[model samples]
Target: MDWIQGFLVFLSGICALLFLFRKFFFKSKLANKKGCDHNCDCH
Candidate 1:
């Protein structure tokens, strides 16, 4: 249906925005840090 296609497109747009935000806006925990333990995401 047309609504299904529109919903898919909206979800894809949201995913794209999230990807962009994660790529450029958010900082990675692996950078410029010291004494990282195995429990952290830096591993």
Candidate 2:
């Protein structure tokens, strides 16, 4: 049970790190588009 809990904690930490990186360090191309509300097949 301890090992299982540790594994879950590790996974949660990884997920949180990835989320933070994506939120702060990475930017989606579509998000930078102007006057585009839906998928415009721009790329």
Candidate 3:
């Protein structure tokens, strides 16, 4: 029983860390629009 509880807690912590990391990094990458024009000065 104790080991199961500990495993659950560890899994929750890993999930929370992944969530925060994606919120900070992956979210921004998804929000930005890719440059479509090859000759655009914005590149």
Candidate 4:
């Protein structure tokens, strides 16, 4: 039971780190790009 709780804590930490990295790095990159790949006339 103790080991199971520890494993869950470790997984949560990893997920938090990944979420922060994506928020800071990937979101900015997408905003700076000057193109739209989605449907509709964005140009």
Clashes of each: 0, 0, 0, 0
lDDT by residue for model 2 (1-43), tens: 9999999999999999999888754345545654445754334
For every model shown, what is its TM-score relative to the native structure?
0.58, 0.57, 0.61, 0.61
For residues 1-43, could you state the per-residue lDDT of candidate 1 as single tens digits? 9999999999999999999888653345344354555644553
> lDDT by residue for model 3 over 1-43, one digit each (tens)?
9999999999999999999998867545544555335533343
Q: Which residue pairs overlap in candidate 1's backbone?
A: none
lDDT of 3: 0.72
**Candidate 4 lDDT by residue in tens digits, 1-43:** 9999999999999999999998877655665573545632333
How many clashing pairs in candidate 4? 0
Q: Please list the residue runs of candidate 2 whose C-alpha ends up more than 4 Å from where it truly belongs after superposition.
A: 27-43
lDDT of 3 at 16: 100
Q: Model 4: runs farther than 4 Å from truth? A: 30-43
lDDT of each model, Cα atoms only?
0.70, 0.71, 0.72, 0.74
Error of 2 at 12 (Å): 0.2
Of candidates 3 and 1, the better by TM-score: 3
Best by lDDT: 4
For model 1, what is the C-alpha lDDT against the true structure?
0.70
Write down the worst ten-residue block by lDDT for model 3.
Answer: 34-43
**If the candidates were sorted by their lDDT against the true structure, best first, what order would they fall in?**
4, 3, 2, 1
Q: Could you tell me the TM-score of candidate 4?
A: 0.61
